[model samples]
Target: MPRTQDFDTAEVVGRARDLFWDKGFEATSIPDLERVTGLNRSSLYNAFTSKRGLFDAAVHDYLDRVVRPRLRILTDEPTRPDAAVRYYRSLAGALASLPDETPGRGCLLLNSAAGFAAHDDTQRSVVDAYQRELSGALTHALRAHDPDASTATLAHRTRLLTSLSVSALLLSRVNRDEAVAVANTAVEQLEEWRRT
Candidate 1:
């Protein structure tokens, strides 16, 4: 008979996610995961098959737990431009609240794109999918701002806004004030677009 797994997979994955988020995929090692997840090497291999597999699982869990929830806040009220503003503001707030010690722990998806995307097709695909989803959410919110706006215009603005949001996250590490300013600019632009 196959041996039953001994540890709680969810707990293990959560720990792995934190480790990956803190250190990133390229820097995080199998031993680090084993230590953080409280699993022996053999058990870790048995459960995840490989270090890459564990990282993949961790990334998926992080997106589901952290990223998707924030995106939901924007898309939830699809007809309110203020909802989009709230979404960006909330993201800025969350980044500002992170402990100073974790300075570069920006968006996990963005970090993955910078570090592992080119190295791994899977990572690249995940990042692209995330960008597309965020752009789609912003597009929906923008459409609500002006029912008469063309789909092409809304999509273009959404892509621009989403790109700005990611750039703000990166800049937050060096200058949080600038990061918040960038987000505010996006909000201001969206509001102006609504007026026109």
Candidate 2:
């Protein structure tokens, strides 16, 4: 008979997610996973199949727990006309609030986009989906913010906002001030649109 699994899977994945966020997949090692997850190599392999498998699960957890929650303002039913503004300001707040070590970690998926996603098809697809989802949510909020905007104008604004948001997340790994500024720039743009 197969043995039942022990330990809290969610907690293990969350720990792994934080490790991966701090260090890219390539930099993360088996010992690192074992240390962070409190599961020996044998148990880790048996549970996740492989380190890559664990990383995949970690990515999923990141999206569900971290990414989606932050996006709630732009995604929840009856999205506010100011949802986009709120979202950008929140991004700025998060970046600005992070401790030195955490800001260097930046975003999990965004960091992966530049690292693993560059060569791995699955990783690329996942990152692309994130980009699409962010852009779509922003577009939805923009429409509510300006109900009479032309299709062309909507497309352009969405593109600009998406770039700014993505750039901020990417920059956080290297420069916290620049990252906060990038995010705040998005907030300024949204506020300007609202006022005009």
Candidate 3:
């Protein structure tokens, strides 16, 4: 007979997500996961199959709980300029709210992508999907501002805005203040784009 899980899967994955976010995938070992998730190696393997499987699940959980909501403002709000401003402002507010001692883990998906091998298709697919979601949101916002924008123009704007978004997150890991400044500049740039 199969053993039943005694612990809450969501709670376990949530803690694991935080651990993976705080420490990059390569740096986070099986022992670290065990400590953080409060599960023995046998239990973890029984639940997740392997360390790679747990990381994948954690990434999915992070995307569902953390990332998608943050990007929802862009998707739901119709006004392009305000939505754009809010997107960056919200990011700044979140970064500022983090305790100074906490390491700015930036985006967990991106952090994992940085260290993953090129041949790692499973992880690569997750990262690609994340980027696509972000790009789609940016494109929607840009199209709202200029309803008649050509496909090429919208694509360019999407790339530009997405770059800024990722850059702000990565920069926050190093310096929250600098990240805020970058976000402000991005907001200003978006406003300028709307003006002309």
Q: Give the CA lDDT, 0 to 100, for residue 35 in model 2.
A: 97
Across 29-61, the per-residue lDDT of candidate 1 in tens digits comes to 888987898889999989999988888888889
Count steric clashes of candidate 1: 0
- Evaluate residue 183 in candidate 3 and report its C-alpha lDDT on the 0 to 100 scale: 78
**Whole-model lDDT, model 1:** 0.82
Backbone clash numbers for all candidates listed: 0, 0, 0
- Candidate 3: regions farther than 4 A off: 77-81, 117-119
Error of 1 at 51 (Å): 0.7
Clash pairs, candidate 2, are none
List model 2 lDDT by residue over 138-176, tens digit each.
Answer: 888899889899999999999999999889988988899
Instruction: Tally clashes: model 3.
Output: 0
Better of 1 and 3 by TM-score: 3
> Which candidate should be chosen as best, given lDDT against the real structure?
2
RMSD of each: 1.7, 1.3, 1.6
**Candidate 2 vs candidate 3, lDDT winner:** 2
TM, every model: 0.92, 0.96, 0.93
**Superior by TM-score: candidate 2 or candidate 3:** 2
